[model samples]
Target chain A: MNLTLKVWRQKNSKSAGKLVDYQVSDISPDMSFLEMFDVLNEQLINKGEEPIVFDHDCREGICGMCSMFINGRPHGPKQGITTCQLHMRSFKDGDTIVVEPWRAAAFPVIKDLATDRSSFDRIIASGGFISVNTGNAQDANALPIPKRQADAAFEAAACIACGACVATCKNASAMLFVSAKISQLALLPQGQPERYRRVQSMVAQMDAEGFGNCTNTRACEAECPKGISLENIARMNRDYYAAKFASEEEV
Target chain B: MSSFGKAFSSSIGKKLVVGITGLFLILFLIVHCFINSLIFLNDGGETFNLGAEFMAGNWPIRAGEIVLFLGLIIHIVQTARLTYENRKARPVKYAAYNGSANSKWYSRSMGLLGTLLLIFLIVHLANFWVVSRFTGIPTHDVNNRENLFAVMVETFQNPWIVLLYVLSMVSLCYHLLHGFASAFQTMGWNHKKYAKLIISVGIWYSIIISVLFAAMPIAIYTGLIN
Candidate 1:
């Protein structure tokens, strides 16, 4: 199979960029999207042209590193699937795919389709963790958390810190991503100590990093490879308000 | 503290200002609507005439107008400031993209609609109040009541002006619908069991106010409920 690719190329963060078209031939239907890109890079290298650069580590879907806006939807046509997991069979022989780097003020283009997603790292650093003391590993049965609560926590934890939610959101809001991190921690007993502070800090950081406010539009969830629920956002809001009260009480 | 300092000191403080100012503007709408609804009271002559009389000359009414003007200024200024802050906070990417379909339409476009509503308000005040007060137009009725109903009738008679009014009303409805629920949310009123119900009620109220306000001019123009 052959495919026409329109890929966004940028020399650096400060440089302007545009979509450049490329043609690839002899693509195997079973090849993963990244593998197909590998084939294209090989062709580019053979022709002495600069190879398109994109972020991908561990071709497996768990890393959340492969970020591409294929056609228009993030991670291509499949729902709840990462770009690395997408196969070339999803397209036809003569498909013209428009690929672009994630265009968020928070995430600037580094080169080609790779973007600097360090803003997400900053938001996490603001407060995406618990400050519990280090100790011997506790028995799994010691906490005895409710099954429903445990399940919900696991679901929230499924967020791979992928910026797909940010990339797909119309307002480029990171509420969904930030909310997922907050919700996962808030749902657990171990995370209870810092729940309020976590949400407030993360949200403040998100806003500080120039992410848009959430209008409760669930587009982030729709495009999220992790299928993170919008309810997580509401939970974050609930926690933020509660945290405000908790902090005041502490003061 | 400076006025700017007061607003920027905290998120909650900013939200409080926006909410109070927003509710104040909403109060003006309720009063304005009640007065206009008097057009349907007593054959479109007696009640409207009396209402306009009070609005134009009554000392108490004059005091109310002064208070109302303060509310309008506060609401517009705070809203503008909040919008500016929100814009600055927004990420540059996906700025042109659409949000989730589940979000309220008004939530995303409030700034645009609010601007249009402001423009309409200026036109409304200029065409009726300013013209009647300063130009010495014969705008009063037999009892020396300001004939606001006549002004409304004349304004709606022009199809182009009526079209503008309709568009403005539609935008107002959009603004109110989102603004209503968002006000409650900012005040931390998120009891899920009742949150959805309250938001639905907000939507209904918005629709009713918009329909009633928009209907008045259309009805008068068509001579339906005269």
Candidate 2:
């Protein structure tokens, strides 16, 4: 299949960017979206032109390293999958695809389709961890956590930190990603010790990063490759407010 | 300011303020709609005048009016700030965005709906509220109550005014359609067992309240309630 690609190109975050169109022929349907880009980059090298730059590490979906807003979607038109998992078959033979970087002030465009997502790292560093020393994996029967609570925690933990939530949110809010991180710990027994402090600090970091607020549109959940729920946002709100009012600690 | 006061100024905290004030406005709509619906009694505006007079004269209701306006101001101010920051969050706009693919148009257009409602509210208050409270309506009911009902009848006589009310109510409906359950979600009151119920009730309430409010102007203009 042959396709037309309108890919964004920029020298760096400080420079202006524009869509530069390219044509590729003899593309296979089974080639992943990134693979198609690889083919395009190979062609650009043959012609001594700059190859299109984008982020991708694990060809598999779990790495959360691949970031592409393809055809007006975070990962692509398909739901619950990353760009690397998107195959060329999703489009028609002569389809024109628009590929852009994640558009958020917090995730500034680094080069081409790549962005600096270190803002997420700062939020995590603020307090998205369990400090307790569990010497070994507790015996399965020792902790006795309710099955329902454990399942909910697991669901919240599925967030890949791909910044799709921010990219899709009209406000560029990181609430879904932040709330998912908060909920993943807030629901578990091991996460209880610093639970209140965790929410307060992480939310502060999220706000400091210049991300916007959630308006409950649920666009994040809709475009999420991991199928993360918006319920985690509500849970985070609950805990954040509870910590503010109930805790006496300065944090 | 206390830490509590400081916390309330955060992004989530500001959203909490918007949600709480929005819910308060929702309650105000219920009261306003109910009193206006009394005009349907069609007793030469007697019952509607009495309800309007009670609302105007009762000290507690008068005091509540101040709180109502405070909620309105806070809601508007907080929303303005949020909208500004939200816009700034994406300094560079997307060349192509398919927002409809993920969220409802009304949900994304809350700011637009709200600005329309604010303009409508100012015009509406000028028509009835100012006339009743300060400017003084030309005629009173037989019981000598402030004749707000008469003002409503005179106001709706203009077809353009009627059209404006109808259009405003449509904006109100779309605003509440997103605001109702959205307020609950922002407050962290949403639950798996009741989230669906909240959304359903929100849809019905939005339709019913807006229809009732819109019906008044149309009913008066058509001589159905005069």
Candidate 3:
């Protein structure tokens, strides 16, 4: 299938960006979105032009490195799949796909469709962990976690830190991303020790990052490649609210 | 800014302010709708008149009115500021977009809906609240109540005023449709088990409250109710 692409191109963060249109033919329907992009880049390089740059580490979609808003969606038209996982079959011949970077205050453009999502790392650094020094490895069988809670925790843990939630949110909020991290640690026994501080610190850092607030529009959940539930956001709120109001002794 | 200031002054904090004030206004809507619905008794506005008198004269409600006013002021200010901030966050608008595909139109258009409500509130207060409170409404009975019921009967007689009131209720319907559940969601009251419940209940809550308030003017203007 042949397709036309209108992709955002920027020389650098300080440079102005604009949409540059190009065409590619003889594309296979089964080719992945990025692979098709590879074909396009091959064509661009053959013509002695700068190739489009985007982030993609694990082609399997688990690494969360792939971030592209294609045709007004986080990961193209397919649901529950990253850009690397989206196939060209989702489009038709002569289709024009518009590709752009995640538009958020916190996530700035590096060049082309790629953006710097290291702010997500900064939020996780703030306290998205259990700092309790378990002297030795504890037996997994020793701690009894409810099956339901474990499943939910695993679901929340599915978030790949892709920053799609931030990209799709009208306010550019990171509530879903922060909430997933908070819910992941807040749900387990090892995570229980520093649960209050985990929520307090993570939320504090999230605010410090200058990301917008969650308006509860659920676009993040809908566009999420992992299908992460909105429940995590609610859970984060519950934990943060409790942490904020808890007495010194209770905390 | 201090750490607390940073946290409280961020986008999240603004949303929390919107949620808290929004929930307070929702509560006020219920109370106001229920009391206003008393006119449906159709007993020449006796029940509605007495309810209005009590609300006007009672000290607790009189004091509560002050709190309600403050809540409205804060809610409007915070909502406006958040809209501006969120707009600033996305400096480059989407060249090709359909936000409604991802979320409801009402949910996305809260700023527009809220502005309409603000206009309606100004007109609404000018029509009744100012007369009842500051200028003193015309007397009706021997006991000399404010005759707010008579004021309503007189006001809805104007077709333009009734049309505006009806349009305002339409805006109110949408505002509540989004606001009621949004307030709780932002407050972190969402549960997997309860999230759907709150949203569905919010739909009905918005419909009932706005419809009840709307039926009053339509009923009065058409002489269906005195």
TM-score of chain B of each: 0.85, 0.97, 0.96
Query: Rank by lDDT, descending?
Result: 2, 3, 1
Q: Give the per-residue lDDT digits (tens) of candidate 2, residues B1-226.
A: 5669857978889999999999999999999999889998899889888888889879999999999999999999999999999998988888878898999999999999999999999999999878888888898778987777878888899999999999999999999999999999998887899899999999999999999999999999999887
lDDT of 3: 0.86
lDDT of 3 by residue, A74-165 (tens): 88888899999999999999999999999887888999888888889998988887776658887779999999989989999999999988
Q: Which stretches of candidate 2 lie over 4 Å from their true place?
A: A134-137
lDDT of 3 by residue, B44-100 (tens): 777878889989989999999999999999998888887887777777766665566
Q: Which stretches of candidate 3 lie over 4 Å from their true place?
A: A132-136, A249-251, B1-7, B139-144
Docking class of 2: high
Better of 1 and 3 by lDDT: 3
lDDT of 1 by residue, A129-167 (tens): 988668998788998889989988999999998799877
TM-score for chain A, prediction 1: 0.96
Best by TM-score: 2
Candidate 1: segments with Cα more than 4 A from true spot: A26-31, A87-93, A249-251, B1-31, B48-107, B128-146, B181-192
Give me the chain B TM-score of candidate 3: 0.96
